[model samples]
Target: MRTLIRGMLEFLRMTVLLLFFMGIIGQLENSVVKMIIGREGYDGFRFGGNFMFLIGDLLLFMVFYRNYLQFRGWYTEEAERLPKRVTRMMLGFGFACILLPITIALIL
Candidate 1:
């Protein structure tokens, strides 16, 4: 049961990290594409953007997997209670994950 809980928490951590990185990569891709094509209003779906997301996410997955492997022993240990500060921070990021897309949509 402890391992199960720990795994779930670790999965949540990975997911949050994935979303954060994807957001950053996506913004960078948009900025670069806009600059290269010299179009300020090119905000529609494009094949290149899809390709970028696929490749960038795959690369990030590999990196995260490698990091997980490096710390596999720690992750497998018995789960313990999280400190209040850590819990708060995780909740904050979780809320950010929920709000970020809406904020971006409003901005763009």
Candidate 2:
């Protein structure tokens, strides 16, 4: 029962994180594009939606990998630290969040 409850909580937490990421990235992208192109008649390709979708895909991968680890008995309360590669990916995502929107805005 405890494990089931914990799993549910983790799933909810990850879902919330995914939504937050999508919203933040989408809004930042929209704001940047509007600012760069003067909010005028610019109806070009929108990268923000693509990026948000990518975030969802990435979250799915994370959840699947976590489930695999749990099944293998590798994920436990004592092994709470995330892998370094995941941390780096998150850092890269953060950097891209700032850089990609500006680049896309300038290009469009």
Candidate 3:
């Protein structure tokens, strides 16, 4: 039962991770990238991409809200046993998330 709950929590966490990354991708590729490059106005590509991104980001934000609560220590990592390689990959991705905004700001 605990493992089941933990698995759900982990899923929530990863879903959050994926959403954040995709939000950045969507924001950059669909809109901000062109804005930074001095492109004016939206095209069909940006329109469709931003539309999808808005819907996806909204849904994912709702779903992963549980993990946000868990991040405050409402959930346990006691029985969490991830493979070292997986953990390393997660850590690396987390680092990338941390750095993304900074990198983008510097670039633009």
Q: Tell me the tens digit of each residue's lDDT in model 2 across 1-108.
A: 888787677667656766775677557656765777667322553777456435544654454445444444422564354577875676566556555645675675
Candidate 1's TM-score reads: 0.51
| CA error at residue 77 for candidate 1, angstroms | 6.2
lDDT winner between 1 and 2, please give it: 2
What global local distance difference test value does model 1 have?
A: 0.54
Residue pairs of candidate 2 with colliding backbone atoms: none
lDDT of each: 0.54, 0.57, 0.51
Error (Å) of candidate 2 at residue 3 is 0.5
Off by over 4 Å in 3: 31-42, 46-108
Q: Extract clashing residue pairs from model 3.
A: none
Over the full model, what C-alpha lDDT does candidate 2 score relative to the true structure?
A: 0.57
Count of residue pairs whose backbone atoms collide, per candidate:
0, 0, 0
Ranked by lDDT, the better of candidates 1 and 3 is: 1
Pairs with steric clashes in candidate 1? none
Candidate 3 per-residue lDDT, tens place, 1-108, comes to 987887787778766766676767566554653555455333433224345445544444433343344355425665344555655555555445434543444464
